[model samples]
Target: MVQSASIQLENPQEWDLSDLYQSFDDPRLMQDLEALQQTAANFRDNYRGKVKDLSAEQVLDCLQQLEAISQQAGFLYAFPALIFAADTRNAEAKQMQDKVMEAVTGIENQLLFFDLELKSLDDQKFAELESASVLQPYQHYLYNIAKFRPYKLSEEVEQTRNQDSLTGRQAFINLRSLHLGEQEYDPVTTPDGKTCSTEAELSALLFHPDRDVRYEAYQSVRKVMQQHNSLYAYILNTVAQDHKLENQMRGYESTLQKQLLADEVSEPVFRAIMDGTKSRFDLWQRYYTLKGKALGQKIRTCDVYAPWGNDPVPPLSYQQGVDTLLAALSQFDVNYARRAEEFFLKNWVDAKVRPGKRGGAFCWYAHGKHSYLLLSYTEDYNSLFTLAHEMGHGLHFAWIGDRQSYFNSNPPMVLAEIASTFNELLLLDYLLKQAEDNPQLKQALITRQLEDQLNLLFRQSTVSRLELAIHDRVTQGSFDQSFVNEQWQSLYQDLCGEAVEVLPEHQVDWARIGHIYFKPFYCYQYTASNIVSLACYQKYREVGKDFIPGYMELLAAGGSLDQVKALRQYVDVDLENPATIAAALKYVEGLLDQLQATL
Candidate 1:
């Protein structure tokens, strides 16, 4: 629900979860849960502790069954999850979500022995199973499991971790979401006498032409975050320690080793991207200096997002935002537009922010052919980009799941952001075209485009660096709120260097960052995917239509192809080599040069 505005903002809306079930109380829900449990029991009864004894055909059959059971469970859980996200205050939905999670835990427990048994096979025996021609389709999925063989805990410990997480790390994440959803922000008066209050509204001021407005919004946001300082810091440390303890128990070499293994990305590739971005910190510094000089002030962290010129991009309604995103995606492929259209036309998108609703957005897909997208979509330039971003994810899920089986439907996390970020790049190009004749507007667009690159490439790298530091530090000793604040501010200074002044208020941003509390070591994916998308965008710039077919093929590829293998096939990117990152760095520098020249 947006407040008063000059334009007619689209009303916030909810999605119809009926496609999954008529209601939460639908008997089908219970039937599916019971059946999932029964199916898991049967699977365990058939395959438990028997991987070494089973023939190749038996292993394949067992995997197929496991896939089917998991899909059914996913379908069941998606509804309550959607309902809870759509309105976290709904008592019935919360109860249903809790019950479903409890049931799913039982299912995880029943199926716990399957993967452990699979990982237990000797190398020669495992090679024989993997070499079976009939098992080719499951090769990617099976091969991924083998990577975790060294880290595999006993079946009992694995199940314990699964069950314990509902109360441990996950509960902290849930609390943080609730804390963010219910928090209030006081209205700040803008230079133009406008009053802003909502999280979305205050956020827009951070990029306002008036420095006072941006400073006030910064102070207001930091004030709200500091109000919950102790709680957020505790949640962050708890989550970090949870990961650290789990890593030690599971025999993981590093805290991030599990995510690397899970994402199917190599260590060298992740480091290459991090090192590449850090090595090119001057580009970030240069952009900040140029933008700050244009505004006639030293750039502060609050001013880091400032546009090159004061001309504001007009407000784009939610419907207009969808149209704009689809039009940009249509330039890529008709199928991309078609899939994106489903989220809007099919009533599959929930684009609203309200008390008790989730604070951010995510596009969710189950075994079904469709998707549901959630966003706190305020009608602004940034909100429009958010729409494009989430819808990109919707298109990816719709395309990939349509072609791949349940076990093979999800791409590596590092590559997951590619389609989403690519859509944003498309939108940026489209926006630039609209501003060709207006100098101020064009400068604003270029500023936004370049700032977005910095945010994704450089800012995410800093967050990743901080996350790694936190995880490594938590292993040794205890930390308090001040300890975290100090580390966060230090990283901020390191990223901004002498170009952007690191504001004292912005250090509390570390406390408010939900991703660090929720998904350990996940922010790096944004950087990794942005680099890959930049490379693909470069190819599209050169070959035009010749790039679309292969690009579309990459989206259609799920876990059926490993990330490095898929990138090589689609874009010939050698992700392991420093050159891939070097290329993206060069692109960023070129964009900076273009912006400086054009503006």
Candidate 2:
């Protein structure tokens, strides 16, 4: 629970997992798990070696069965996974999560032959399968599987890898999570000598108006990371080595290519984001300089996230925040607002700040159902934005669930952040409109908007660059903590220039980025998605009401359509063109102009 005076909500919301399961002891949960295992076994026995020879109708039948198994397995996985996320220290939840994971992996291993056999089919046979009208509903899914034909290993080898991951690559990932959840941090003291502990409480101080409090809170985080630097370095290196060996085994040319293939994104599009953002480092440095000028002092790296002026954005209770979000969404589309409200009314969000809870917010969805949003809300401006961001994800998948099947509900990584970030933009637009008469409030809102773009566009690109460097360096030779620290410092130096002082503790920051340890190449999508959303928002501004229908259509398309084609079809955005990035940056420059005028 948030014991800090900073808490504004009298009673924060907690999610009801009963939607998935009444309790861990639910007999239905065990029955479903056993049935899922048996179904997967039957599937393997029936079709393991016959996928290539199956007729179109037979293939469609197998696909429907496969989809059912996936949906059931996903449901089972969600219950314990969400439970563990809400409370990592729950022994029963962690055990159940592990058990479910092991079962799911075994099941996946059994089904591996289906895809491997399909991939191994001769081109003529595959083409014949594709030409079947019966398979039209899964055309994109089949096509996606075909895209990885060149990289897949033999069935036996694939299953071996899958089974080994329980103790291999995945165990280290779990270690990082469990370790972070179990450890306690040093108490951060305020100017009045008040002490704050919990990660959420300490993190909230980053936005404190007092610079020393921000610095102390920042140091409190960094000191812990520094102490655990060696352990994190080992985990990172081991995961990198695992990926490297897998790439070699599977014949992937590079790590980046392996990740991009899943997103259906080409190397050129990724390079465009990397080069496009790095080229605009000047804009990043300029904003910090402007921030320093406004604050009457040169800012430190810790001050980068500090409140902009003497008057930070006023705190709102949980209800007030939700109401404001509902109003903003209602203005865009009544259906969207209604969908956003469901999460709150249904107790689908976990907003309480408690020990053993994970540090940031995330929206998790079960197919044919709703999304569960987890965040430790401290009732600050950032928490309000966090609520909006996660709600964006919730609303997005709700639309997806209504329009697509389980397998097709998850959008590609590059397109995943679109709805979430767009929600933040809507919230900002609403806040700005409401603050039109108050200059101080207007400045705070505009500054928040500008700084958000800077973080998503510039800071994320730097993180991606560091990821590339880490992988590239690992391929050359083994590295230690100093190597990773140097890579982080050098990258920030290039991005921040001399505008802000890069503190020594900041060098160990790489160890704290969960994405680097868990999901490789994930940070870049933040930059990529922000670029796409900004362009979409710009179009909305020009076309007004007409844009809502197309935007809704884009969300409803889900993963059934090729993301690139879906964007072009629903909205006129062409991500293939490098000029798209330039247009987005031009919009950022317009934001800078707004800030300058406001100042």
Candidate 3:
């Protein structure tokens, strides 16, 4: 069973934002909406048919104007959607979110002709526009658009595809989010002997210090899911089928191929990371054995996350956690520290738990203007780590906010995890050093850190491999319920090895991972990014002051460069190297050795 961390803050505040607009119903939103409609109309009127007649400079100006208009509207749409996610029960916010999504989708459809029309221009005309000064800033975007020239369909067909997407493929995603993805768990008696059954409460049970409670919580959650499996199976099958159909229509060779193309990463690089992780399954098996011994159990699936011994939950105040994060970040770069401090001072974080709030944590950046974080803060060591993790994402967005265009603003998921995981590594190392005087505390911290690494790195990689296999089988018309369950069980057993006993429900574990339903093959990036970040963290430790500038530059680069180029410039780590994964595993092994010796 997966227990959630505790969330006990009362009077939790929402994001205080007067930066983008005055309020949700502020005049500025209306003004932007009017301007967007006008500009989009004007763009269609001016450039819809005269692309061959316009000079390169004129074309660039038109593109820039369109980009600016789209970006402003994006900012307006994003904030409310983020706020709604933080509290799904907000009916008004939900309605506004749906309205904004429809508006944005309509606007996007209006601009869909711009690319196909541009691509239709003759070579000489296209070349002239590419060299225009006004368009130089967006040359990369233009170049990418041009790259799709060969794949371009007729303008009418493209428009139909664009419009159909919102109501067809995209609407299915919304349906899944609203219905199938909600995990309902049965109420369990808390330590105070009161029964509660909220998502937050069920999450807390996963980390329960008592093995029996953790097992019971796991069963209760799975039972609810088991009852809903048929519904979930329907959602999964439909989404996967939608993706397969779209990929075929888009001329993509495979589902993973589409993701790789979008991520700007090579299939070889992704496969390398998977292969490297498969080679290091023993590290996870060893760690689980140690964890099982520590918990005095023959490790059931629920015991994977069970607390070690009866150690008192280390109390971490919110301010203390912030200070700890600031101090650790200061070691790498002062700018990161300052940016994090600004988030707290400005109330950019909604850090309290309340009724009807969202279940998970995320950092939301609306048009690179400001970042908002949503989390239910609990005063525990893991909470501190979580704070740092989300703040890492916030800082990354903040650093690059001013510099990147909308198209280049968001990094790929594989690279996105680097900043967050790097923060975790820095905080863990800092805490380990601070606890050096207390051997037992140091051992416990080390164990906890290793547990996290196992989850994010090894275990997530295993899950990704299973997902890839499942998708591949589906493409070959071989996937079914039994096929998915068998593959899940195989991966779990492989990772656990002989060190632990796999429970029965654990066989259908893939059904519980929300990402597979929404984000196919996204879990592998968690493993890859952590491995890449370990190398980056090692550089920061070795080079000290010299590493700060490079680190800051990497964050500032955002999605301006592809993942490989960005990492190469920032940390000099090659994704193709098997040694990168080996190095990360070696670090994990060292931590385990230290814990074993000390404990």
lDDT of 1 by residue, 1-599 (tens): 11112323367556777888989769999998987888888877877777789988888888888888888888888998888887777778878887898899889899888788889889998898889998899888878888778888888888899899889888788878767767778789976688877676778788787777888898887898888888888888888888888888988877787888887777887887888888888999999888877778899988877766666666677767766677777776776676666666567888876656776688897765577888877777778888888888888888787688888888888668898998888888987887789777777767777888888888888888988888888988767788888888998798888999998877788876677887777888888888888888888988988988888789888778888889899877667777778888888889899977864
Give lDDT tens digits, candidate 2, residues 1-599: 11122323356799998979998999999999999999999988888777877999999898888888998888899999999999999999999999999999999998988888999999999988888899887888889888999988988899999999999999999988888888788888887676888788888998888998898889888888898999899889989888888989999877888888987788999998999998999998998998999899898889998777796667777767777888898888887888887787778999998989988889998886788999988887789999999999899899898888876888987677999999999999998899989887778788888889999999888898998998888777788888999999989988889899998899998887889988888998998889999889989999999998999889987888899998999988888888889988888888898788767
The number of the candidate with the highest lDDT is 2
lDDT of each: 0.81, 0.87, 0.74
Q: TM-scores across all candidates?
A: 0.94, 0.97, 0.91
Clashing pairs in 1: none
Better of 2 and 3 by TM-score: 2
Best by TM-score: 2
| lDDT, candidate 3, at 145 | 67
Per-residue lDDT of candidate 3, residues 1-599 (tens digit): 11112322234346776776676778877677777877777778777777767777677677677768777777878767766766677777767777777777667767767777888888877877778777666666767667667667776777777677667766666665555325556778857595656565566667678777777877877776667666666666666777787677778777888777766668888888888778877878888787777777788887776677586556677766777778887766666677787777777888776656666678888764788888876666766788888988998888778687776778877678888998998888888888878765676677788888888777888888887776677676634566677788888888888987888887766666777876788888888888888889888888877887787788877777767777887878777777877898888888888777855
State residue 537's C-alpha deviation in candidate 1, in Å: 0.9
lDDT value, candidate 3, whole model? 0.74
